[model samples]
Target chain A: MGKQVPVAEGVFTWPSDEPRLIGSKCTDCGNVMFPTQSGCPKCSGQTTETVELGRTGTLWTWTVQGYPPKSPPYAGDASPKTFEPFGVGYVELPGEVKVETRLTVSDPEHIEIGMEMELTFVPLYTNDDGDEVVTFAFAPTAS
Target chain B: MTTDDVAIVGIGMHPFGRHEGVSGMDMGVSAVRTACADAGVEWSDIQFAFGGSAAAGNPDTMVSKLGLTGLQFINVVNGCATGGSALFSAYNSIKSGMFDLGIAIGFDKHERGAFRVNTRSSGLGDWYGESGMALTTQFFGMKINRYMHEYGISNDSLARVSEKAFRNGSKNENAWRRKPLSMDEVKESAMLSYPLTQYMFCSPGEGGVALILARADQAHKYTDTPVYLKSAVVRSRRFGSFEVMAPSVALEHNAGPTVDASAAAFEMAGIGPEDIDVAQLQDTESGAEIMHMAENGFCEHGEQEHMLAMGETEIGGRLPVNTDGGCLANGEPIGASGLRQVYENVLQLRGDAGERQVPNNPKTAYTHVYGAPGISGVTILAK
Candidate 1:
């Protein structure tokens, strides 16, 4: 595989032994958010501190993408010929926020709500620079 | 209190389906002409106007086709609540005594897969879309999945909702999906998102709808059977509420905006859910209808299963919903969607709806529209 790289910068800590999703917590309202927002949505305060979020969370809810999404917006190979269904869901990092992410499994029967899930990474696609770009996901903790 | 005396005098719609050669504005112009004729008024009679479309261009530009009477025309573009917001603007125009008469209009022509949103344009992070997590259907799926698990809603109930939409669509001439499909067909249709089948979702399509509003006291001057606009309310989602296009949600699942809009509509109308004779709830997909029934105060959370099993939402049932078929059948032209509900409600109130009319001469009707970025609008009409 080509040198591993994150799909985008600032979403999570990269090039590390243990990467945790990056987020922001409001100093005023204590409301937390993903990917680190500069402003606090909860308290209308610009005062927010960048923080590393919990790596483990519970699967709050889930569903599978039965069809390939449209491109220009979608970077993955969405051609009908090679498209494979994948799971999408929200994972609740306790006392923080329920982060919407891609799930490791596609079959509905395989996953259940409230299943303990942990942060993981999957190859989204390859960049032109010969780097294997990756994206974040949550998987069954026991898996 | 200044806005309590508005009435819809006339309603018109350009049958919602594919019209290859027709531009969205052309449809809007035709609907405007028909509405004026139905109200027995000339285009010059309207003192102000508010209308909108998403894919379609600025609505105020229609003044060229509508004749340059130089009326104050405002353009609204509130995602799915575009039509409702336009109507609210027009209702207030007359209710506030600023104008004697006005028009609220909406129209749109969307690409076949137009429901697929581009997160980039919405100011979302690029990675959110690039990583294949931007699908709107996924949001609907997760939400319904969670709701069903929490409320004990059977898979069969989801199919039943689409089954009902198709059955009702078959009876409405203007609806796009006219052919009725069985519950089994709904259940068996290719799963677009788990718990939601292909047939369970609405395709994006073309259409236009317009309503003419006047002060309730002067409504009789135009139409003898004026339907009073008892209330028109729009509400946005609170921070903790689970809504579309969210990368993360709050742990505390607060009520969505529909609950707020629904309650406010009933409050402004001086009536409760039980008093509404018939209704049209947003049915973007089968699951939305199921959830909205309770969100709009039609029933309890877990009662949808029993309600679907008993056909309580059917045309002849206790509370007829989407009597002219909803987005699940008519398809969604986001701009025109909300007003289409109001159009159907007006027909029901006037007893002008032919074979699909609700029984016992329905005196009151409610229309609700909910959509992207988490907003809901509700309108109550009374005869």
Candidate 2:
């Protein structure tokens, strides 16, 4: 479930006590990129600092998945026997950055775009050692 | 302004679908042959050529597939606007007095899987690592979220757009998905991306479209009552920024809180939204069609749902849009979709749309093509 790969080096740590995604911020343009870009796209300046993303945000829009994604890159650990149609949505942090992730909610019909949401990590797939590889996901904030 | 600018003399299209047997080059050549025949011209008469395609393996390979015969060939690729980009290239070449005759061909046969990446390129790094960032569907999902926040629009409104598109597509011979759909059906469909159901997104269809552009002075020599290009304008977003401005789509007639490229297009065309008798907007996705209604100045932002409720965007509505059943129904072939819009406008203006035709003869019409991230192209045509 953890690896010290180049993309994850320094910026990302495995099983942190506090779960969050690490992004490099370009102080010049105030732009934050995921998977951490070495430099800012706006000013061509190096990303001087690293930052952690908030675990809570607002749902921008959402829908339920009816089919498996075509690529293996997205194949998750849930067995077809255990697979249930799940909802997905985009959550907007107050900072204007948006991300796409799975939605955890009781009912898909009630999901709306502007609803408040919180982030959680979900296992996407299992590796050779049968360890679960988790990724960030989101769910509706409790009313 | 005296009709010496440009005219489309020939229009041809390959059937839209998942064509596994034919290469993009084969499709483009087939469409070009038909267009040349329709225009009563020989291959040698094509003084200039422009090729458009999104995923043809290689850009140069796709352009070379057209076999230009060394007659001033140009290649253009602008995501979904590939067809429009090609058209614009030929139109400009003729308008610039460089050539009196030109051909624009757009073709595509999308790969049957996730989008590919150029990891092999030396410059690949940074924002380029995650190819998912460029996925148009996710970007539009964000816009839908904002639309919901500002307008309080309901999902039913978005579903209805698909309902209309599916119904129309079912009747279209060239459409990919022929089954008619209901709002409930659309609502229940599998989610491809948040805020975008499978029905809302355009399925990749393999096809090619060819258009012959002749200078205005020579237009009469080709055909009478030629379709005139009022204006062709394109706008692109500032790279490396998250700033979302008003989209430039030309659907809305009223200004909203958002900013778009349509205002400038209207000013250039010397006509307002009210003057447009027919418009063929790029409806790559259902939410996009609804959003375009506001972004293009057809109505205020977030007013699209109510407008749809009133049956305003239907074929017989006050503002008939996507009369040929938009990309959702007709199938989107990326590079060919834009020219397909122009072809539909030409048919409507020429009084040949058949069963799906608009009632009154439309003298003025508009076609808009948008692409990945934030690229917009608006073209005004008149008879």
B-chain TM-score, every candidate? 0.98, 0.88
Cα error, candidate 2, residue B13 (Å): 1.1
Instruction: State fnat for each of the candidate structures.
Output: 0.85, 0.16
What DockQ does candidate 2 score?
A: 0.23
Please identify model 2 stretches exceeding 4 Å from their true place: A1-11, A29-35, A38-48, A75-87, A104-106, A109-119, A139-143, B57-68, B111-142, B191-196, B239-259
RMSD after CA superposition, every candidate: 1.4, 4.9
Docking class of 1: high
Which segments of candidate 1 are over 4 A away from where they belong? B1-4
For candidate 2 chain B, the 10 contiguous residues with the lowest summed lDDT are B243-252
| TM-scores of all candidate predictions against the true structure | 0.98, 0.84
What's the TM for model 1? Answer: 0.98
Candidate 2 per-residue C-alpha lDDT over B1-383 given as tens digits, one digit per residue, 9 for 90 to 100: 56456888877778777777788777777888888887788877889888888765333454354454668777787766688778877888888888898888888887753343332232333222231222345456556756676788788888988888877667667667778888888888877666668777776677888888898878767765578787777766554323222111111122322224577678877899889988878677787788777778788877887888998888888888888788887777777888888887887888778877788788888888776545777788888
